[model samples]
Target: MNLYRELAKEQPYFVLSDMQASMGMDAEAKRYMSENIRSEWFLGMILFNTRLLHRAIAKGVVFAAALTRSPDDPPRTKIQFVATREKALELLEQWRAQADGGRG
Candidate 1:
């Protein structure tokens, strides 16, 4: 858990595995989400090769920007689930288009 807390320091979102074929989401991860995330706006994108992590999407941080698709995965709405890196990047561009939206 300490490692994850340190990871949260580096970015708005952090991928839990390094070059693994897949990632596993567990209760400990959820605990970290509750204690670590704080987003006044949208949370950053998390690209994973697995569907088990979707449960984290409800953490109350903010937008996903997009979650790259995993076939056999269930349909997800209200949050974007992309099919590729290019698609995720495109969604990011679209999401930031409104920027702050407070200026005239």
Candidate 2:
């Protein structure tokens, strides 16, 4: 998180791959993820459901295509669930380009 705060020029995109186990975090870690790690940029989670409505209904906020709702701390972290790492990185590129004034 320190590195992201210091170096990330664009929005922070967290890649949750086979780390589903990691999601079962303890209170402290879960609190940190839910509160401290606010991603206005995007959060690409590698899960099955990519539909906005489903995510909204199940997780609170919705994620459709490359767009997502910016939810504040409390309910959950704002995350966009992708299918794979490639897709996640693609979303990161999209965010980077957007941050870079749509250059390249």
Best by lDDT: 2
Best by TM-score: 2
Score each candidate by Cα lDDT: 0.43, 0.48
- lDDT, residue 10, candidate 1: 68
lDDT of 2 by residue, 1-104 (tens): 56655544565454444344444557686545444443443343434324554344324323232144334432323355676567767776775586578887
In candidate 1, stretches whose alpha carbon ends up further than 4 angstroms from where it belongs are: 1-27, 41-78, 100-104
Residue 102's lDDT within candidate 2 is: 87
lDDT of 1 by residue, 26-79 (tens): 668656764554432223443434253553554333433123334464323234
lDDT of 1: 0.43
Q: The CA-based lDDT of model 2 is what?
A: 0.48
Off by over 4 Å in 2: 7-21, 40-79
Worst 10 residues of 1 by lDDT: 13-22
CA displacement after TM-score superposition, residue 27 of candidate 2 (Å):
3.4
Q: With candidate 2 superimposed using the best TM-score fit, by how many Å does residue 57's alpha carbon deviate from the native? A: 11
